[model samples]
Target: MEKVFNTRSMIFTLYGDYISHYGNVIWIGSLIRLLKEFGHNEQSVRAAISRMNKQGWVQSEKKGNKSYYSLTDRGRARMDEASKRIYKLESKAWDGIWRMLIYTIPEEKRHLRDELRQELIWSGFGLLSTSCWITPNPMEQQIHDLINKYDVASYVTFFQAKYEGMSDHHSLVNKCWDLDEINARYTQFIEEYSQEYKLDKQKIANGDMSDGSCFVKRSLLVHQYRKFLFIDPSLPKELLPGKWIGDAAADLFTDYYHILEKPATRFFESVFEN
Candidate 1:
């Protein structure tokens, strides 16, 4: 299955994983080369950069002839919030309390409703019904901000309550999440990297891991793993099934990621003068 890839998303990944740590700045030429592996042409990458700049995600600066791109304050804040979800592994024990957020944005405000739905999902909520969303963790602040932003506080309700359904927790999990699909994706991730991890280890030990190769592989790994965010609710462990494959995938990713970091840094440094 060819998972969807967007030039825009890839650029974000590049900045978040690499440039964010270095100085939040990237050379245009280096960026084009980085995006080339994903089949994005320089024109398209340039367009993506321009779009990001217009959207307040990035700003461009010229130094002599070469140009550089860096995240704007707005973009950094956005990435910071997103990174919380991407790297967060829920740790607090589930209190068995489900926080429910219900909204009624009316027909004319359907756009607001749609936007709110996406925000809720991003905040780890699962839909119980069209009007109601639930999460095991309390997201009062997120919900409050969303409501205030949309000016729909009067049309929304937030409640902390226990489940009163007849179904078991397993049934609820199945209903809230597509565990089978998530497991399949995790299994795929595991299969792709577990064997590669061994070879990568050997390469590192033998000093055969090239800087460019490390950069490419690490980028692919990070980009691929990020797809999980679109599907994963990041549910707490207590709410997950026994032997969740995501746990294994996370472990493998962390292991391989650290191994590639040094070489990838070397590659990036060589490409970006500053």
Candidate 2:
């Protein structure tokens, strides 16, 4: 099957990976040039960025007849969070306590409920029941951010408590998330990227890879790995399965990213600086 990328999502990846490091701003023309490496055209890039501006993820400035875009505070916060997760060395030790959230928002506020669910999932909260979400990680700040962002302080309740149920804690985990499925995804990422990493590393060493090619490969690599955020709750070692492949995937991603990093940045700056 042919791969397809959402233009807006690719913009988010680019901003998080590249533009954010370079003053968090890029001329619209320069942004279009960088995205062109991924087969995104000018019109699509323009439209996607316009939508982001409207959604408060970015804001635009006019430089004479030229336009530039920069991350808004919300955008910077999200990018900071994503970068931390993406490059994390390890999950912290579990404290033997699960953080839980339950909500009772009225049906009339279904939109807020839906959006809140998505944010919770993105922050590693797995659905335990129709109205309950659970995680084993420390998430006090994330919980506070979600409540404030959604203005659902009255509708939501958060807790930090040990699981004293008849079933073991692992059973509670199984009820909330599919560890087997997440492991399978990690396996796939390892299989595909391992081979690509070997090939690209050899190419770079042989001086056969161009900066532009490296830039494209690196961006795609980060984009693919970033999908794990939605599926993998980044459970601590104690909560994970006996033989998880996520660590292997993380290692491969980090090593492969290092191989592509310098050249990719060169290419990005070549476009972004002009």
Candidate 3:
């Protein structure tokens, strides 16, 4: 299997485990155990711990060779936000129906099978058995929409609730993303960037527009765009307005992208490649 590391997902996974099993005091051994369960090797787990600690989400104290760790208040706040996002995405009332599904695509359609399975997993579905999927939440409509969107209606069959208490790994995984930290970092970035560009309302409103150039606007737009991208792209259109505060936020995002997109891309590329 190809390994993927999404910062949001990884952070959620770590903190979610802390909240669930350790009540925040996650010892080194416990963290190692959990990481092993998630298919991480010893080195990777150590690196993750170091990186998170450096980023201020976790604090660790070393007693001899043993390290004990716990979330900082900032980390705790991030965990709380991640939990809320998970609940919003998955805690819909159970309709007393499982909405199980199975696909019977031809052998040549094996690629489709993988795609469908991934889609189901992303939508918070659980694998019950070979070719069978279920969810604790009543998301029959979502399943139906996916089936139609993927053109798999012919190769798939749906059934009503046959099983209960299906475990949702997505919610569990999402809890680790450290949303509070992510939000905090972004908030700090916006504030500093705004000040650096002299776009602070008091500054800009008081004839300081000399420094309020396109750079400030571009920075703000990029941050906002990244924020919206964290949510599901397929969410109902009505949920996000096209404009905010008498500005076409989407259009501004586009303009910002044109200005900073290449340079920003290069900056991240250099960091990651190094």
Candidate with maximal TM-score: 2
Assess every candidate by TM-score. 0.86, 0.97, 0.33
Question: lDDT of candidate 1 vs native?
Answer: 0.83
State the lDDT of candidate 3 residue by residue for 1-274, as single tens digits.
1224433344345555223334676566655553443355667777877888887778898777878777887577555644454323323333444456888878888887887877676554656567877654555776777677678899898887543325453343234233344445545544544444333334445645332232324333433444433433222222223322212333333443454444433332232211
Top candidate (lDDT): 2
Ten residues in a row with the worst lDDT in model 3? 238-247
Off by over 4 Å in 1: 1-4, 60-68, 148-151
Per-candidate local distance difference test: 0.83, 0.91, 0.51
Candidate scoring better on TM-score of 2 and 3? 2
The global Cα lDDT (0 to 1) of model 2 is 0.91
Model 3 clash pairs are 11-176, 11-177, 12-175, 12-176, 12-177, 13-176, 13-177, 78-180, 98-161
* Candidate 1 residue lDDT tens string, 205-246: 899978888987888888888878778887777888887898
